[model samples]
Target: MDKAQIKIYGLLENYLEYCKTNGFTDFEIWCEDNIDSANEKGLVQDIYREVNHIADKLFD
Candidate 1:
């Protein structure tokens, strides 16, 4: 994985933890709410794709 991919993966890891800790059952909803935070952290191109990819790997 490239640096961006790795960073996104790490972010998704944290997001998963956040969801588990906070009782959030919907990944899409969490993404909708927190995508801007990812953007603010410098995610741009392929953000959704990358996030989905990481999420699938972790949650599937």
Candidate 2:
């Protein structure tokens, strides 16, 4: 991952952790902001794809 993707990955990982710790509903109510942030530098899809089940954990 490039620096931007790496940074977004870190941010998304933190969000995923929040979802797991706090419950998915209470976190990431809408992922638009996250997507937009990712789009600023990289694709959120790439991050999710690379992380495998992290997408499921965050958005399943």
Candidate 3:
């Protein structure tokens, strides 16, 4: 993957770790609920799109 993709993946990994540490067992549910928070934090557009796409696949 390119640097940007790698960076996004790292961010995603960190997010998942945070969720797990905080007792969130359902990734899709957590992501669905907190997507707007990520947007509010100004997450990179590509990362946001990738995360949304992954969440859609997981939930749908």
Candidate 4:
């Protein structure tokens, strides 16, 4: 895989571990709450957007 794909994969893996650490097994649910908190904190971009960007980077 390319750098972008590798980065995204790593991020997803990290996120999954984070979810497990927090006792969350559902990715969608975890993402929902994470996205909301990210938005509330005015992060550079929300989790969904980051995921999209990563996807684009991987494919493009």
lDDT per residue (tens digit) for residues 1-60 in model 4: 755445444556766566545543433343444333433333323354555455444433
Better of 1 and 3 by lDDT: 1
Error at 43, model 4, angstroms: 18
TM-scores, all models, native as reference: 0.43, 0.44, 0.41, 0.39
Clashes of each: 0, 0, 0, 0
Q: How well does candidate 4 score on lDDT at residue 57?
A: 47
Query: Per-residue alpha-carbon lDDT of model 1 for 3-32, expressed as tens digits?
Result: 656655676677778755664444444545
- Scanning candidate 2 in windows of ten residues, the lowest lDDT window is 23-32
What's the alpha carbon RMSD for model 3? 7.2
lDDT of all the models against the reference? 0.56, 0.54, 0.51, 0.46
Give the lowest summed-lDDT range of ten residues in model 4.
Answer: 36-45
Candidate no. 3 TM-score:
0.41
Ranking, lDDT, top scorer first: 1, 2, 3, 4
lDDT of 2 by residue, 1-60 (tens): 766666665667677776666654422333345545545334645444544455465565
The alpha-carbon deviation from the true structure for residue 39 of candidate 3, after best TM-score superposition, in angstroms, is 15
Candidate achieving the largest TM-score: 2
In angstroms, give how far residue 3 of model 4 lies from its true place.
Answer: 0.5
**Cα-based RMSD of the predictions, in order?**
5.6, 4.7, 7.2, 10.2
Candidate 3 lDDT over 11-41, as tens digits, reads 6786666654563333443444444444433
